[model samples]
Target: MAAAPSGPVGPNPPVIAVVGPTGSGKSDLAVHLALELDGEVINADAMQFYRGMDIGTAKISVAERRGVPHHLLDTMDVTEEASVSAFQADCRAAIRDIHSRGKRAILAGGSGLYVRAALDVLEFPGTDPAVRERLEREHAQAGLRPLQERLRSVDPVSADRLGDARRVIRALEVFELTGRPFSSFMPSREYFQPAVQIGLDVDRDVLRDRLAGRVHRMVDAGLLAEVARLDAAGLRRGKTASRALGYAQFLKVLDGESDTASAAEETIVATRQFARRQLTWFRADPRIHWLDWQDPDLVAKAAGICASPASVI
Candidate 1:
């Protein structure tokens, strides 16, 4: 068990973020903390933002929320892209609203960047349509190698970091628009506001079993039906939502390229892989106070951390 990070120092209470890999019970723990602390939950999970994505996303149900208000969940249609910049604004606003009402703001999710965007001193560069279009055209005409070379010339760090053509193009576009390396815009650990992050640490073998069982349960809970319904609603047109873990695999089932059993297995594998990546991402953050996911005193420990006085920043 790591020592808890210092708590909030100013007039407002700290934004409490419960972070971990999927199937680590972050949602349930957040709800419990909210009940204990008189807080409202503001979702940091990007996938949970879309409406009708409940089953696949494992979104907390209304009854499960237990009358503690949850903000930002089900706020977007499946057709809309989940924008971190937009989410940063909305999440900050939600925090302010919760604070003004004298409630603690509890953020819960596995999406690392989204969690950071809400809590860190991150700036998003503006984009120009013409510049983006030109980059896209160049990528299409000459392939990713040429664009990769171009980006390598201007911003080698971003070039090395970004893998896909879309992100690489966006990196180039940012450099063209801002005359700055895309790496310069990357978030620092400095918080935008006072915040405390509590991470759920689960044993790797245990998490693997949990993720597999969760995927199977999701399939049994009509995940394929949910995907079919969303597919009918322009899901494939949406760049982000269409590629969600289970939704993507189940779409293969819908297209006759796979069976439900195969999709479920694939989803389980992909989800476990994603969980590993999530662990890697969160493990790098020293500020996160990690707790055993199965700790019987988890909520009590978390609330105590929240109550402790923080070092003045």
Candidate 2:
């Protein structure tokens, strides 16, 4: 049996994970669950970790958090690399701390790997700066196509999964360092702790409309201005932060390659694609209990999952 973070207790409450696509109301659900269960939230969204990335990431505002304590948001500088390995350690520690205080730990976000790293028996491969630098140099000199081809030849699974050049390079670096395919390091379906995952489901057509409206709302909420501020703060120097959906599109605007309207449309399209990918990732995990995003009694249903010992463990 899993022990509560406080110590060896009679029965340890399970950690709750709120997961779904980008515009699927996971944040609101997480807050509701936290309030209902006396829980704290640990962020699994990799982008939300950057201190100044608020509006575009749809980070829950202080007022929206509903008096529930949240951990791991705004934890990194715009120029720092977000590491899954580091997040795993920090998340486990946060869960333990919340448990010590006799509150449940709610892990919330759409980031699949980050969530898995936190709650599953996943081990990250070691990184070598020399290898990474070589891959970076190759990418800079030869572009993504050549490196992507190399990754395709070596790790076809990762090649199919990774669309961005940075990830492709990273996968190649891992293969070079370990003499093993990057996919070989993928974790089996085993929980690192007693946990329950609640995934939000939505119809694809409705989700597309919702995502488009959300992108428009974000733009109206000053997403361009937010990107401007981060750009000034050396956002381009950050390997991970620079590639965030909204941020990347707007950066093209700043570079005179796109306009605000076009960037908004591009972001919407990219987000829709990303949402599909997120669904693919979470749906593959048979462990997640899916709930419809539009359910009228959403909070109560999720709360039931938290309260039921059989459903949780």
Q: Name model 1 segments beyond 4 Å from true.
A: 1-11, 311-313
Error of 1 at 172 (Å): 1.4
Tens digit of per-residue lDDT, candidate 2, span 1-313: 2222221233356888999999999989888887777788888999999998998999999999989899999999999999999999999999888888788889999999999998889978899999899889988898899998999999999999888877897899889888899988898888898888999998999999999999999999999999999999999999999999999999999899999999999999999999999999999999888899999988888788766667655
Top of the candidates by TM-score: 1
Identify the leading candidate in terms of lDDT.
1
- lDDT tens string, model 1, 120-148? 99999998989989998988888999999
User: Which lDDT value does model 2 have at 251?
Assistant: 94
lDDT of 1 at 153: 97
Q: After superposition, how far is residue 87 of candidate 2 from its true place, in Å?
A: 0.7
